[model samples]
Target: MSEVKLVLSYKETIQSKLDERTKELIIHAKNASQNAHAPYSSFHVGAALLLSDGEIVAGANQENAAYPSGLCAERVALFKFGFDKRDRYLVKAAVAVPQIKGENLVPPCGACLQVFAEYRAMQSTPIEIVLVNGSGKVLIAPDIYTFLPFAFTNRSFKYFI
Candidate 1:
C-alpha cells in the first residue's frame, strides 16, 4: 500500500476573479436564485450555464413535497441545456448565492459533480465553473476535473463486459 494525496486548489475571495463573460453569467444565476422553490430547506440555489453561442440559461432549485424528489439548480440548468442544445458545448457555468446568507459559497453535491464530469467528457474541451455569493465571496474551478479527480467517466466502465 502507498500513501496518496489529492490536492484540490481553488480561489476563494470577495472579488471577482473571472472574466467578464463569467461575471455576467453569475449575475443571471443570482437573479434566478430569487425564484427558487425551497420551502423545506430555505436554501435557494441558482445556476447559469454559458453556451458557446454566447447564450446564457439559468435555473433555480425546485424542491418537491417528497424530499427525495428535489432537484438541484446545477442539474436543472445543465440538463435543460443538454436537451435544448445537444450539439453545443458548454463553455462555463456559474452558481450564485448557494449559502443561506452568503457567508460561504456552496459547492455542487456529489451527484451534480458526477453529472458535470460526464458532461464535460462528452465534449473535447473543458467547461469552467464559477461559484459566487451575494456577499462577494467567489470560488472558481478551472474545470470539472478540479473538483472531482479521477471522476467516473465512460472510460471507467469501458472494459466491462
Candidate 2:
C-alpha cells in the first residue's frame, strides 16, 4: 500500500468584500437557519446551494424524535437541487449556523461530503463551499474535496478495471 496526500485550497475573507453571489448565499443561509426544525439539538443550521442554471436552493436542518431520522441542512439543500434539476450542476454551497453567542460556520459532515462528491463527479467540476460564521466572516473553499481529504472516489478503483 502507498500513502498519498491531497491538498485542499480555500480563501478567507470578511463579509464586506464578498461578491454579490457569495453575499446572497450567506444571506440565504442565515435566513434559512430561522426555519430549522431542530427541537432536539437546538442547534439550527442552514444551507444554500447555487446551481449552474443560476437557481438557488436552500434548506434548514430538520430534526426528529427518532434522532437518526434527522437530516442536515446541507443534504436538504443538495437534495432539493437534485429533485428539482437532476441534470443541472451545483456550483457552490454555503452553510451557516446560529448560536446563542452569535453565528458560526460548520463544515458539512462526512455523509454530506460523500453526497457532494457524487454531484461533483457527475458534473466534472468542483463544488465551492462557503462557510460563514455568526460574525458574518466568510471562508470560501473553491472545492469541497479540500474539506474532505482522502475521500473515497471511484477513481481509486480504476486500476481494477
Candidate 3:
C-alpha cells in the first residue's frame, strides 16, 4: 500500500523584524482583544483581516449564553469582510489571545479554516496568517493550508465536473 503525507509550513519571526504591514495587522488584533466578550472562558481573542484594498478589518470574540451561538474572532472578522466587500480578496489574517498573565497566540478553528479555504480558492491566491504569542513573538504561515493540512477544499468535489 502507498502512503500519502501532508506537510504544514510556517515561519517564526521576531516582532521587531516583521514588515510594517504585518506589524500593523498584529497591533489591530491585539487591540481588538480588549473588546472580547468571553465571560465564560475569560479567554479573550481577537482577529484582524487585511483586505486587498489595504483596509484592515478587526473582530473580537463574542460569547453567548447558548455557547454554540457564539462565534470565533476569526469568523467574525472574515464574515464582516465577506459581507462588506465580497469582491475583495483577503490578503492576510492575524490572531491574538490574552492569557492570565499576559497573552498567547492561537490558531483559527476548523470552521474558520474551512471558510478561509473557500475564500482562498475563489481568489486563487494565498492568504498569509500571523500567530502572535503572549510575549509578542510572531509566527507566520504563507497560506491557510499550512494550518490545515489535508483540508477539504472545493477541488474535493471535482467529481461533479
Candidate 4:
C-alpha cells in the first residue's frame, strides 16, 4: 500500500470586493438564509447557484423532526437546480452561507459533498463553490473534488454492472 496525500485548495477574499457575479451570489444566498426552517438547530443555512445561462436559484435549509431527514442548503439548492434544468445549463458557481450571528461559513457536509460530486460527474464540468462566513471571509473552491477527494459515485457499483 502506498501513502496518499491530498491538498484542498480554495481562495479567500472579502465579500464587498468580490466580482459582480460572486457578489450577486452572496446577496441571494444570504436572502435565502432568512427563510430557513431550522427550529432544531437554529443554525439556518442558505445557498445560491449561478447557472451558466445566468439564472440563479436560491435554497434554504429545510429541517424535519427526524434529524436525518433534514437537508442542507447546498444540497437543497443543487437539487432544485437539477429538477428545474435537467441536463441543460451547467452550474458555473455556487455560494453557501449560514445565518448564525458569529459563526464562520464552513464547507458542505459529507452527504452534500457526495451529492455535489455526482452533479459534477453528470455535468462533466466543475462547479465553483463559495463559502461565506460571519467574519467577512469568502472561500472559493474551483470544484467539489478539492474537499471531497475520495468521493464515491455510482461507478462504485461498476463491478455489479
Candidate 5:
C-alpha cells in the first residue's frame, strides 16, 4: 500500500454567484425536495445530476415504513441515472438539503458517497459535487473523491471471475 495525498479545494459561495448550469442544478434539486416523502424525519432532501448529454435528472428522498429501506436523495438520483444511462457520463451532481439553524449543509451519507465513488470510477472524467442549503449557500467540490478520501474502489478488493 502506498500513501496518497488528498487535496480538497471546496469552494463556498452564494447561489447568485454560481454559473448558469450550477444555478440551474440547485434550482432543480430544491424543487425536487418538495416531493420528498420524509414523513418520519421531516428532513426533505433532493438531488440532481447533470449528464454529459446535456440532460439533468432529479430525485427526492423517499422514506419507507421500514426505516432502513428508505433512500437518500443522492442515491435516488444517481440510481435512476445509472439504471438506464450507465454509458452517459455524470458530469456533475447537486444535492439540496434543508438548512438547519446555526449549521451548514449536510454532506451525503457514507452509502451515498460509496455509490458516488462507484459511478466516478466507471468513468474517466471526474464528477463535480455541489451541495446547497436552503439559505442559498453553496459548497462545491472539484470531485466526489474530495468528500471520500479513502473511497473503496475496484482495486481495493480482488475478485475471482
Candidate 6:
C-alpha cells in the first residue's frame, strides 16, 4: 500500500506588493499591536479581521503573569468578532507581529489555528489569511486549510453525536 501526501500552497511577497485593501488590513493589525499588554515576553502580536460587511475588527495580545492564562492576538480578535457580530462572516484575516531587524514570520499558535478552523467551518467560506512578518514580508493563504489541512471538524465526532 502507498501512503498519500498532501501539499498546500500559499503566496509570499513583500508588503508593498499587496493591494490597498490588504495593506490596510495589515496596517490595522500593526496598529493594534501597539495596544498589546505583554509585560513579560515583550513579544506583541495583533490580528485584524475583515467582516463580510466591510468592517475591520482588531485585537492585541494580552499577556498575564499567570503563565497559560494569556491568549493570543488571533483569538482575541476572533472572540470579539464572534460575540459582537455573529451575523457577519469573516472575509479575511491578518496577523501582524512587531517589526524587527530580520524577516521573522510568526504564525499563529495551534490553539488559534483550531479556532480559525472552527470559524471557517461555521462560515462555510474561505477566509483569506494574510501573515505579515517583522520585516514587511507577507504570506497569503487562500484559506485555513493551507495551514491546518487535517484540522478536526464536527464530522470527527459524528459517531458520538
For each candidate in the order shown, give its overall lDDT on alpha carbons.
0.84, 0.85, 0.87, 0.79, 0.89, 0.90
Task: TM-score each candidate.
Answer: 0.90, 0.90, 0.92, 0.89, 0.91, 0.94
The candidate with the higher TM-score, 1 or 4, is 1
Off by over 4 Å in 2: 1-3, 100-104, 154-161
Which tens-of-lDDT digit does each residue in 1-161 have in candidate 4?
99998888887777787888888888888889888898998887888888877888888889999878989988888899889877565565555554433446578888888988888877778888888875667888888888787778776678677
**Tens digit of lDDT per residue, candidate 3, span 18-135?**
9899989989998999999899988888899999999999999999999799999998998898889887899999998746233445789899999889888889899999988667
lDDT (10s digit) by residue, model 6, range 67-131:
88989999999999989989999999999996653666888889999999999988889989999
How would you order the candidates by lDDT, starting with the best?
6, 5, 3, 2, 1, 4
Question: Where in model 1 is the C-alpha error above 4 Å?
Answer: 98-103
Residue 128, model 2: lDDT of: 93
Candidate 2 on 9-81: residue-level lDDT in tens?
A: 8878878999898899889988999999998889889999988888889999999999789899999998898
Return the top candidate by lDDT. 6
Candidate 1 has which clashing residue pairs, if any? none
Q: RMSD per prediction, one decimal?
A: 1.8, 2.1, 1.9, 2.0, 2.1, 1.3
lDDT of 1 by residue, 21-76 (tens): 77788889999898899999888899999999898989999999987898999999
TM-score top scorer? 6
Look at candidate 6 and tell me the lDDT of residue 112.
91
Q: What value of lDDT does candidate 3 attain over all alpha carbons?
A: 0.87
**Candidate 2: what lDDT?**
0.85
The candidate with the higher lDDT, 3 or 4, is 3
Pairs of residues at least 3 apart in sequence or in different chains that clash in candidate 3: 99-103, 103-134
